[model samples]
Target: MKSVAHVYPWDIIGDPGAVQRILDLGVDAVALAASYHTVRAATPLHPEHRLVDARHAALYVPVREQAWGGRRLTPAEPSWVDGPDSYGQARDALKAAGLPVYAWTVLTHSSRLGDLAPEVVVRNAFGDRYPYALCTAQPEVVEYALTLVREIVEQGQPDGVVLEACGPLGFFHGGHHEKTEGGDWGKVRQALLSICFCTACAARCTEAGIEVDTLRAQVRNAVDAGEPDSVESALGAELASALAAVRTSVVAQLRALLVGEVRELAPQARVIVHASADPWATGPFATAAPELGVEVDAVVAMCWPGPEASIPGIEALRKLAPGTRIAGYVLALPPKPIEAAAMRAELAALAAAGVQEFHLYHAGLASGARLAVVREALDSLGQRP
Candidate 1:
């Protein structure tokens, strides 16, 4: 199995030794964050780099023009952009080190864009807008994402592209020190709340013969009542099934568009999607359905440890997309604790379960000891390359 590491561009800029540090980890490829949402962070190497800390920000590489031949996506100079040319610099450095660079592109989770264009953001059944989650139902958002893919490929020139949040992100964001209390917001309720009711989504449902109004009311009632019934069952089984299928189709259509665009723009670069094991694609990827038959080089299953872990996801994707490769995204920090033995075990398990590549999460955020643990694990397992 190929071993890969995920790194933020700032991680490379903040530390002079970042490239060598990652190379020492024995990873074959580096999945660099190309487009990202707002974030606050403190870099281990460059403590002075105070661009994204305590404040949510999007890490966007400035492009000269939009790939779709539309108006340039100029984000007010400082709203969404982080550093100019950082992606190119970091990518070149990694490639020079003989490490393959895959642009780890985050597609929809962007508070910056959502804030700039509230109309394009996802709205719940109650018309409550989620400023952090950009709705894919919006053509403007889709255009922006296509432009991002083209620019990242044309500018950064990555060997591959790892698409994350390629669809609508769910409501449960990892806000700092989050705290909430209420009746059990189980999977069913969360799923109900996750259904997008934006103008475009409603139109799509209507086109698919779904009663948009009735579906919205049912979802609102389900959330308000805090009940745990299958979202489809509550919405009437046939209608629910149709609506769910509609959502899946919506995502599949978008994925196909973007994938086709990538092929046309950068046919040489491999496409890898971070997707759920669930065929419906309802967890993190509320709209994305890899099973929609979009051709990807690999499907990534985020198999971080726990109840919602990746082993099941790997198993599912292995069955669903048997022809494509399965890459396991593993956590290398706290809770998982960057330990050699643990890392080795996880790597071995994923490989045994049909994972062809292991993408280590955040080499930039990990401590030196953690990186060392990764190196030891990779070395001991002989997973180099």
Candidate 2:
């Protein structure tokens, strides 16, 4: 099976030894995060030892012009101590080390732009704008995403590009010292609140023969009453089916847009997408997989498992898109055991499930021991043909 590792550009710039250390891990390819959203504290080893505040950061690499395809795409704030073109530098260094690099691009999930243009943000049934999640139904958001992909393909010169959060991001966000309380909220409730009711999205639904106002009111009532499961039954099968299809279709169209843009702009670069096992509420895997076969080279399922974690989604996806490659994205750090044996078992199970490739979630944030676990797992998994 193919062995790949995900990494942040800061890790390479921050730590002088990062490249060698990664080479030591024995991965077949490296997935470098090209365009990422905001984060509080990140340590890039360039200046050595000091923690850098990378809040609402943009391209880790120095962009030649702040604009992509004549549109002004935001860059990471000046707080980044490294040079603006850090991405190119990092890719060059890794390439010199003989490791292939893929651009791990994140399309949405940006609070910085959302905060600046609240009008483009995703609004729920209650009309509360999620200041972090940008709605793709908005034309400008799609344009920016296209520009970002075009720039990465034309400039970065990566072996491939891995797209993550390529569609709308849900309410779940990682803020520093996050806190929450009250009822569990559950999957159904979260899904209800995650639906975007922005004018653009509503317009698309209307075009699909869906009554946006009625659907929105029903959703609002379901969420308010804490009766998410009852939502479908209340709406009746016909309306429910229409609403579900519309919601899923919105995300699929956005994914198709980006995939098409990349293929047209950078035909040589391989296109792999981060597809979640459960593609609902805020993701696009389930509904988009069939159409994606025409564009995507492979689907990397986010199956970060624990000791007893089961990956039924792998089989489910295989059935949905029979001939497409189904890769597994494993978490190398906490929430997952750091033991090499546990990690190996997880890899073994994924391989058994007919997963032809494995992409380790992250290499930068992982501790030395955790990384060692990853290395051990790769070593045990043997080589990919």
Q: Please provide, for model 1 over 1-385, each residue's C-alpha lDDT reduced to its tens digit, 9 standing for 90 to 100.
A: 6888988777776566888888888888899887776666546655455344425544446656434345533332224234677777778788888999998887787666677778877788888787777778788888877777777777777888888877786556633465633546776776676788888889989999888888888888878785755776667778878887777776777778878877887889889888774534543443344363778888888777732366776777777677888887778888876568877777777777888888887787777788888888788778754
Model 1 TM-score?
A: 0.90
Q: What's the distance in Å from true for residue 50, model 2?
A: 6.1
List candidate 1 segments past 4 Å from native: 46-59, 65-83, 174-177, 181-183, 227-229, 279-292, 306-308
Report the error of model 1 at residue 19, Å: 1.0
Best by lDDT: 2
Going through the candidates in the order shown, the clash numbers are: 7, 11
- lDDT of model 2 at residue 341? 92
Q: Which 10 consecutive positions of candidate 2 have the poorest summed lDDT?
A: 284-293
Give lDDT per model, in order. Answer: 0.73, 0.74
